[model samples]
Target: MDLINNLALGLGVAFTAQNLLYAFVGCLLGTVIGVLPGLGPLATIAMLLPVTYSLPPLAALIMLAGIYYGAQYGGSTTAILVNLPGESSSVVTALDGYQMARKGRAGPALAAAGIGSFIAGTVGTLVLAAFAVPLTAVAFKFGPAEYFSLMVLGLIGAVVLSSGSLLKAIAMIVLGLLIGTIGTDVNSGMERYSFGLPDLSDGIGFLVIAMGIFGFGDIIKNLSDKGTKRELFTKKVENLMPTRKDFKLMLPAVLRGTTLGSMLGILPGGGALLSAFAAYSVEKKIRLQPGEVPLGQGNIRGVAGPESANNAGAQTSFIPMLTLGIPANAVMALMVGAMTIHNIQPGPQVMTSNPELFWGLIASMWIGNLMLVVLNLPLVGIWIKLLTVPYRWLFPAIVMFCAIGVYSTNNNTFDIWMLGLFGIIGYGFVKLGCEPAPLLLGLILGPMMEENLRRALLLSRGEWSVIITRPLSAVLLAAALVMLVVVLLPSVKRKREEAFVED
Candidate 1:
């Protein structure tokens, strides 16, 4: 009953003329960005962040959130049409999606992804509505210790699930922590890593770093792969619907992916990406008869499974951010920043104090997902045509858009300079075989972790043992330790490497 009422209220807010228009626009733009090579939802959202400032908070977030997951849907288009993944989560999609395209099953693969994404996204949004309030209620009981413990668990989970060398992931996380420390010390009003630079005092801009690393970094990598010709499949897309046999195969995969995604998405870090990969792995493990399509060999299950998981994960990833004030990914972190700019406290109190924002956002997700499906599926022809644009003409436009977006955030040249610096660092990471996701997780959590640690110490009168003494905190620390140990085991180490793409 409460769910229905809240949803009704949310619909009331979300269905307004202005909000509806923005949601549709965001879906379209996000799909466009997703279809383009080398761009992802994070960079698109970061680029569009400045525009949100002019709109109501609910409207702005609705649009931004639309862009975030709408890209997840659009990403499969490229994965099937070309062998490129337009977004990180869709990389796995390309492994089988493009293969399916080569086998002239492109239509079914895309249709599976689109339909699976719709189902997962809708169900995930419903789950979010169901869980948001109770989680927020639970969040009310959290003290600094609990909050810190939760964040610790989140960071650990991120590192554990990340698809890279464990050591490199840890190193990247530590580096992010160091980078996060570059701003002023809030407690002491003292500069820490500012090095006498005014811009440094505010710390590195999250948007700048995100854009540089994921956005520009990807562009450079694609450009550097000079001879890698993107073969666009122009094969006729007959039967743009999954067959009954395809449905039978994909149903279980979708269910498995949705379940995994819903569970993991609540954890901080790269939950969406992790869930996608995990879903694919799960589908692969479900043994099949001889001559059945292998996991990475253009199976329709591959398209449905990961697409469902990714969308479901994307939807639920908001739980920690809204309830606990802990962002699960870069986009959620940016949402937090946006909420702060609007003077909205993001923790448990948000449910009680700002029910409108909470419910409105939840409701808008449903609206946004519906809008995305309606906007994306029939427009496949249009999106494919976009693939025809030569990379030479497209790359410069993308670069220019990125530049304009970065400059608009604060209207400061310093941010542009910082973006370039981070771009170089991002490229270096690619070269050095480092994964940047864990680093981003650390950067997002570092300050909160520091604050909680300091407060815990202060409350305990400098007793460092307090962390171990508190049952919750102790459990979290133990979990992190256990994770480290488990990953170090020879069997687990090999498995972890195989699961994650090479850096």
Candidate 2:
């Protein structure tokens, strides 16, 4: 009943004219960014961070959150139309979605992605509202040992979830951890990998890495595809609405994705991205009846499942950040920064101390997600036309935008250089057939893991056994180990190889 009352209060706050306007604007901008290749939610949110200083904290946070999920919806549009993933979470969508476009079924794919997202986003928000406090209570019981174990599990899950050779995924994670070490050491305040540069002391900017890898790297990959002119799937886009068969196929995928996403989004690391990949894998495992579009040949389930999963995951990710002061992803970390700037501390006390803000943010997710569907569906035609634009024109413009956006962060050109360097690295990863998703998880979790490891050691006076001796930590570590073993088994290895090679 108290939860109901608080949610009502939240609706009141979120429904204000100003908040509502921002919500609309946020969804619109998010869609635009999502459709534009290379500009992810992290880069977009970071670029917009400075501009939000004058706004109310709740409104600002609400807008940023809107952009994050809005990008998810927009990403599938390009993935389906151009075989280019506008967002990393949409990469799985490209497998079957692009095939659908080739067959002139792009309309159904887009519809499935959009509608599935709407359902999942709504259901995920409700789940977050119901479980956030309880989840936080569980989080509160976690000590440093437990936190470290959780991080280990997160990293392992990341590697297993990546779509590539296991060894390659491991290499990517190691590389990410190495990149994560470039900053100064927290305990001794000594620079471990700075290489004598002052900027290195503060660490490689996440904005640079994200922009270079996701933004610039994409540009290079698309350009190298041996096509002088760009190709767009110009299917007259008849019957913008989905058919009955489309609904039948997409419903189960949406439900499964929503379930998977709601559960995984609460974890740390690339929870949303992992949810998308996991959902796609689940969809593939289910044998289909005759007449069903085959998975990876442009099946609507491919688009619907992952799209719903990621959006739901993105929504539920707020649970950990809000309730436990634990940032599950880079964007969530920025949210934490925003909250701190507003003189609000995130954690268990958030519910009691700022019930209005807490509930309002939760309430606003529903509003923002609804606005996304409304904003994106009608705009699909507009986005599809973007694929017709030439790479010669598009790449340069994207590079320029990235430069300006990175420069705006700290008014520093060094970040631009870092972006270029990381872009090369991103391209290298592409050539090596390695997935970058796990790398991102490592980058996000490395510092947190280091912090928790040190705290646990300090609490136990340097006893290494504390991690395994603690009940919660032991269980988490054991589960992670078991998962790793299962994934590495000979039969599982053969099956994974077959899945990747499946025609």
Candidate 3:
């Protein structure tokens, strides 16, 4: 009864003219960014952070949340149409999605992706509403040791789910952690690795890393491959809706993806990107129907599952931030930054003290998902036409936009320099077949892990055994070890190799 009344309160607030307009605007902008390769939710949100300063806190947050999930929806459009992933989570979508496009089923693929996303988003939001209170209660019980151990488990899961060689994934994670430590030391007033550069004292911007690696890096990869030709599947999209067979095939995958994403999104380092990859891997491992295409060759399940998982993960990743005040990913970190700027502390108290704001935000997501479906389904042909645009023209424009976007954040030219540096590094990662997603996760979690580890030890008066002695912390650490062992197993390795590889 309380849940219903609270949700009713939320719906009332969300339906306000001001909030609806912003939600629509955010969804539109996010979709535009997602249609273009390299400009992901992180970059888009970073670019738009300055805009949120003047708006009401509820409107600002509702808008930002819309953008996050809207980009997830838009990313699949690019992945299926152009064989380019607009967002990292959409990377797996490109595996079979592009193949489906090539086989002249772009309409069904797009419909499946969009429909699956809508279903997943709704279910994810429901789960969030129902489980938030209980999760917050559980969160209050976690001490610093448990937090650090949970992060270890998350990092290990990243390694387990990463597509490339285990050794290389571990290396990327280490490199990310090293980069994360480049700023000032928290305990001491001294800067650790700034090399006398004052700009380094504030630390490398998440925007810089994201725009550089994904935005500039994608430009470098696209330009270097001059012979690439894109085929437009728009003409074949005469039937915008999915076939009955597609509906039958897609429902199960959507349900499974929603479940997987909801569970994983609550983890420390897991988010839409991880969820999509994990969902795709699982779909590939399942038994296929007799007449169905192979997993990597235009299988509708491949498109439906990952797309659903990604959106669900995007929605549920909000749980940690909303309930526990802990960010599960880079975007949620920015949301935390938003909350702080508004003089609102993020925690269980947020629900009590700012119920209107909290519930409104949740309610707006459902409306936003509805807006996305209405916005995207009609725009499918236009999105497919984007592939027709020449790379030579597109790449230069993207590079310019990235330069301007990075510079606009903090008005720092050094950030632009960092962009160039990471571009080369990102390109290198691509060439080496290394997934950059895990590296980003590692970078975000590294500082938090350090802070928690230090605090846990301090509370124990420097007793090292406290990490393993705490019940919850011990379980988390043990889970990390198990993940490591499983990842190293010969059979799991072979299956992973098969899962990530495309035909």
Candidate 4:
């Protein structure tokens, strides 16, 4: 009964004229960015953070949330048509989707992707709504020690699950923690790493770091790369609907992918990219049906499963951020920044203090998903036309937008300079093959971890044993240790490496 009432309230809030309009705009923009290679939801959100300042908090959040999930819908369009994945999560989609396109079944492949995504997205939203309140209730039990231990676990999970070298991921986390400590010490009222700069007194602006690393850095990297030529398998996408056989093959895969993605999306360092890959691996293990295309050879199941998983993963990834104030991924980190800008603290209190925003955001996701299905299917030609725009013209506009967004945050030139500095650092990370996602996690969680650790110590009279004496904190810390141990095992290490390698 309570859940029904809450959803009812959410729908009421979501149905507002302004909220609906922004949701549509967000969905539209998300599709546009997702159709263009090299641009992603992270860079796009970072660039738009400053713009969200003037809008109502719920509307801003609703729109931003739309962009994140809507990208999942648009990414498959390019992957199916041209073998170019618009988003990282769509990388697996290109493997078999392109093959399907080559077989002149591009329409059925795209239709399967769209239909699977819609079902998964709808189911994922329901799952989020069902779980968010219960999780928030559980979160209210956490104390300082538990929160700190949870963050430690989150960081470790990031290290274990992230691609490439474990050493590099750890190093990035440490670097981010160091950078996070640059501002003045809040309790002591003394500068720590300010270097006597007034701007550093309040700490480095989150917008600056976000824009520099993701926004400006991406532009720099995209410019340096020798652009690859993409060939469209079919210029005209006909037969918008899938055959009965295609549906029979697609339904089971979509259901399986949706389940796997929902579970994985809640874990730290797991989101659309990981979920999609895992789903594809699972599909490969299942034997093909009679008369169905084999796996990776234009199989409809291949197109459907990963597409469903990625979209479902994208939607459910919001669970941790909304319920615990913990970012499950880099995009969630940006969302935390968004909430902070509106003076709305994330976590359990949000449901009690701002139920409208919480429920409204949840309801808007369903509406946004419905909008994406309509937008992606019929308007396939427009998205393809967008792909033809040259990088040379698109990049400069992105750079300019990023500059303006960063500068507008504080109206300070120093922020712009910081943006440039971080941009260079971000590019350096790319050159060194280091993943930047962990760094963002570290930066966002570092200060909170420090504060909680200090508070727990102070309350326990500096005994330090309180972290283990408390059952919840002890369990969380133990989990982190176990995760570290399991990940370091030789067999597990090899499997982890295999999981991240793209075919």
List residue ranges in candidate 1 displaced over 4 A: 289-292, 501-503
Writing each residue's lDDT as its tens digit, candidate 3 over 1-503 gives 87788889999999999999999998987787788764677756755665677899999999889889999999988888888887778999998899988878888898899999999999999888887778767877889998899778867877776667888888988887888898889888779789999999978987788777866776788677756565555564656688898888989999999999999887766789879988988897898898988888899999999999999999999998898776777678768766876888877778878999999999999999999999887887777676566668867766777788778768989988999999899899989988776677777778888989999999999998999999999998999998889878999888777665644
Model 2 ranges off by over 4 Å: 37-39, 42-56, 79-109, 228-238, 243-249, 267-303, 325-354, 497-502
lDDT of 2: 0.81
Best by lDDT: 4
* 1-503 per-residue lDDT for model 4 (tens digits): 88889999999999999999999999998998888988999999999988999999999999899899988889999998999999999989998999988888899998999999999999999999999989999999999999999999989988887888898999998988888998888779899889899989889988888888888888889899997777865367898789998888999999999999998888898889999999999999999777877787899999899999998899899999999999999999999999999999989999999999999999999999999999999999999999878988988888889889988877899888898999999999999999998999999999999999999998999989999999999999999999999999999999888987766
Best by TM-score: 4
Each candidate: RMSD: 2.3, 3.6, 3.3, 1.0
Q: In candidate 1, which residue pairs clash?
A: none
Tell me the RMSD of model 4 versus the true structure: 1.0
Steric clash pairs (candidate 4): none
lDDT of each: 0.82, 0.81, 0.84, 0.91
Better of 1 and 3 by lDDT: 3
Candidate 1 contains a number of clashing pairs equal to 0
* Candidate 3 error regions (>4 Å): 78-106, 243-246, 267-270, 273-302, 325-353, 395-397
lDDT for 355 in candidate 2 is 80
How many backbone clashes can be found in candidate 3?
Answer: 0
What are the per-residue Cα lDDT tens digits for candidate 1 across 401-450?
A: 77887898789999988888887888889999998877777887898899
In model 4, which regions exceed 4 Å deviation?
Answer: none
Model 4 has an lDDT value of 0.91
Taking all chains together, the TM-score of candidate 4 against the true structure is 0.98
